[model samples]
Target: MKKIIYTMILAAGVFSTTACVDELDQTPHTEITSGDVYTSAANYKSVLAKVYASYVIAGQEKGGGNKDIATTSGYDYMRCYFNMQECGTDEMASTWLEGDKVKDISYLTWDASDPWVSDTYYLIYQTIDYANEFLRNATDDNISKFSDSDRALIKQYRAEARFLRALSYYHAMDLYRNIPFVTEKDEVGSFTPPRYTSSQIFDYIESELKDIDGDLLDRSEAEYGRATKGAAWTLLAKMYLNAEIYTGKARYSDCITYCNKVIGDGYSLEGDYSKLFNADNQKRTNEIIFPLSVDATHTVSWGATTYIVCGEVDGNSSENPLTYGVKSAWSMFRLRGELTSLFASGDKRAMFYTKGQSQYLDTGIDTQTNGYLMTKYRNLLDNDSVASNTASYGASIDFPMFRLADVYLMYAESVVRGGDGGSIGTALGYINKLRERAYGSTDGDVKTTDLTKNFILDERARELYMEGTRRTDLIRYGKFTTSDYLWQWKGGVKDGKAVNSKYNYYPIPQTELTANPNLHNDNY
Candidate 1:
C-alpha cells in the first residue's frame, strides 16, 4: 500500500512534513494562518500529521535546504534522542575522531554546549510546541463548525496531540531531570516557561496520559502512524518501570498493569525478528504499535533508519551501499566491543559484520576497525528488495516507537522486580516466544531459575540494542555511571572507570540556562 501523509508547509503557522508526492497527495499548502488553518476538517488531520512528521523530517523542504534547527538538520528530535540513548552506553561507538559532539557523547564527556545536548532539549520542545498549537485550535468552538462526524474525529485528534506532548516532556524529564515547561493553556508569547520540579513533570506526564485514555483510538482502529491507546499504555509502562529513578518510588506494579493492557491489545510478535526493522516494515503492523513513517520517494531526511543503515557501512570495506538500500556509506558507527560479549553463537540477535573488525576495541574508537559493525537495522525489504532512496532522500523503513516485543519485555522485567499483577509463568512464556524467534527454535529458552535481574537486562540488550533503550536500561540497573558494568572508553578512560553520578542526567544546556534565569540544574 502506498503511504499517505498530508504536507502542510507553514513558516510560522504550522509544523509539517517536508515532502509528499504523487496521487492521493493533496497539493502542499503554505503560509496557513493560525486562525484559519483549522477551518476545515481535512486541515485538522493534515496538521496533526505534521506534528507526527516534524520529528522525522527537518522542515518544509524535500530534504535538507531548510530545517527547524539551523545548527544541524540531522539533530531533529529522534536523531538527537537516539544519540543520547545509544552513543555513551555499552551498545554503540563511533569511528569519527574526537573533535565533535557525537564523539563527545561516545566518551561521556559531553558538556552543556554540546550541539546534540542543546538540540535534544530544543527539538523536544519544538515537538511539544507543535502539539500544543494543535491542541489550542482543537477547542470545542473550533470543531463546532464541522459536521458531527468531523467533530468526533477532532476530539480523538485532540487527545493524540496531548499524547504527543506527553511523549516529548517524557524525554525532557528523563534527560534533563528538571526543566522549564509550556502548554497550550499558557500564553504563546516571548515569556519564559516556568521550571517545574522533576516530580511535577512526572505527575503531569502521568496525568496527561490518563486523561487521554478514553479519547485515543483503540490499537486496532487507529492509523499506523497515529497515537493509540496501546501507545499511551506502553509509554506509561516504560515511565512507571523507571518510576523510582524519576519520582523516588517504585511503580513496578503500575508498570505491570499497563504492560498487561498493551499485551491484551491486538498486537503480536513478528514471526521474523529482522523483518521488524526492514524497509517493508510498514506492512508488518502485527508488531509496530506506533510508527514514525518515512517514504523513500517523498519524505526525506538524513535521520532515523537512514542514519542507522548508512552509518553502519564502511566505504573502505567491501560493504556495498546497495545491499543496505542506501546510496552512500558513512562508515561512522558500529557496536561497541562490550556488546559483542553479550551474544553467543546461533543467537540471531547478533547482527554483526565481524569479518574486518577486532573482537575487542583498543583505547580509541577513532577507526572503522575499533568494534564490529551492526547489520541489524537495514533498508532491505522483507522480500529482500532495496528501495532506491538517496542519502538525502530517506529510507522507507519506519521506526517503531512502540512494539509488542518491547511490551512483553517490560512485563517480564516488572515481574522479575517482584511487581504484583503479573504472573512469572506468563512472563516466562513471553521470554520463550522472543527466544524462539531469535534462535529459530526453543534452544535459547531460559528456565525460571535463570530469571534474575541480570538475566533480564542482558536479554533486553540482545533483543533491543541500537533501537534506543540501552542508556535508560543501564541507568535503571545502576550500571550506567557506576563501576558495576564497564565498557571501553567509558568516562573517557581507556579501561572504563566510574564517573560522577551527575553524568547520569545531562546538564541543562548552557543556552537554555542563559535564556531562562528561572532555570537551574542542581545535578550539574
Candidate 2:
C-alpha cells in the first residue's frame, strides 16, 4: 500500500520555526506520528469516533475535572430541562444563591488549576487535525475499500468534522472571547497567533460553516448523527441571532432568514417533547440536529451518561437506570423562578424535573440533598432488553446539540428584532407548531404571539432549559446580568446579578494571561 501524505498548509504559522525561534532554537516535539494507528483507514475512523467521544462525560467523580464540565449543566449555567431540587437554597453552589458561589469566576485561574480548560481547547483542535488529515490523505484505494455510498459517507464525516470545529470555536468564543482561530491541522500548538476579536471569531465560524454547508446531506443517514444542512443552518441562525452581542451589529433579519430555511427544510416538532430526550427514543422525532448518534440497539455510547446515579442500599437512587452517581459534583442548573412559572399550569414539561427533590435516591450519597433531578436526560431503571423492548439501549442515551424547537424560538426572536410581517408570521408559525405538539393540540391558549425578546427568552427557557445554550442565551440577550424586576438576575442571585457589560464576556484565564502577556482581561 502506498503511503498517503496529508499535509495541511496553514497561514497561521502554527508549527513554523519563525514564530518559536525566540523561545528556543531546539527542535519541537511532534505529538503524533505515522505509527500503525495514524496510517490506516479503520484506525482513522476510530480516531474520529474518539473525537466525538469527548461529548461523553469523562469525569464522574468530584475530584476529577468532570465536575467542571458538568457544572455547565448546573443552575449557575445552562438549565434547559431544569431540575429544581438542584437549585434549592440548601446547595451553596446553586446560581440562585448570592455571593461568589455561582459567580462568573469559572475562567479565572488560581495559579495551578487543573489544565482542563487548556486541555479542552487543545483536544478539540487535535480532533480537527485528525479529521483534516484523514480527509486530505484518503486515496482511491483507501476509499475503494468501501462502496461508493460509504465513500460519500466518509465525505459526510469530513463535513461533520468541519461542523465540530465550528461548534468548538463557537463555544470557545462564548467562554473565552479572546481566542486564536485556527483552520488547519498545522495550526496546532501555536500560541502566538493574535486572538481574534469576538466579531472575527463569529466571522470565522460563519465562513467555515458556509464552506462545508453544500457538502452536508439534506437528511441524515441511519446511525449518522453528524451535522446536516439543517443543523448548519440552525447554528448559523443562532450565530446571527447573537450578531448584536458578538459583533455589535444587528443581523436579526439574517437570523430570521436562516431560521426559515431550517424550518422549511422538512424538520418539525416531534409529537411528544418527552421523546426528544427519552433513552429509547434515540433519533426520536423532533431532532433537527444533535451531537450523539444512536446505534442499532438504541444505546448512545457518547451521550451524557454522567447524569446517572447508582441505586443506594437505602433504596434511594436517581431517576436514571444506569445508577452511576452524579459523576461530577456538578449538578443540573434549575430554571429561574421566572422561567419555571412560564409553563401553563398543566404543562408536561413542568414534570421534566423533580424540583426540591432529595438527592439521596439511587445516588450513594446520604448527607448531600436538595435541588431538582434532571429528568430530561434521566432514564427508567431496569428497562426491558432491546430484543424484548421497542427501545432498549440497556444504558446509553444520545444528546441533542440542536433541535427544531430552537429554530422556532430563534425565528421568533429574529422577527421581533426585524419588525417585519414575514418575520412575525414565520416566528409564530414555528412557535405554534411547537405549542400544538407540546400540548398535544393547539388549544386556544396554547400558542401566543406576544413575541418579544423577553417572551422568546421565556419560550427558550421553557423549551431549551438544560440543553447547554441557556447561559449563552442569557448573556447575549442582556438577561445574564439583568438586575431589573423584568428577567433580572438581582443582587440576591449569583455574582450581584446586576446587568453589567462585563458580565457579557467571561474573564481571560489567569494562566493564559501569564503565558501571553499581550492578552487582556475582559474587565480591563
Top candidate, metric TM-score? 1
RMSD of 2: 8.4
lDDT of each: 0.81, 0.50
lDDT of 2 by residue, 253-362 (tens): 78877877877777767776766654454545346465554232322221243332111101232443333212222342333344445678555666434434543222
Candidate 1 lDDT over residue span 1-524, tens digit each: 43646455353565431111111112334555667678777788878887887777766676644566565534457777888999899988877745445877887877887888877877787778788888888999778888999999999989998998898899999898887878877775555678897789999999999999999999667776778898999999999999999899999999999998988877889998888888888888888888888776656767767777888888877677787877899887888878888887789989888877786678477667778888887888767877646565677778887888889889999999999999999999999999999999988998998888899899999999988899989999999999998888898877898888988888877866776788887756
Find the 10 residues in a row with the least total lDDT in model 2: 76-85
Give the C-alpha lDDT of model 2. 0.50
**Which lDDT value does model 1 have at 350?**
90
Give the 10-residue window scoring lowest on summed lDDT in candidate 1. Answer: 17-26
Provide TM-scores for the models: 0.95, 0.71
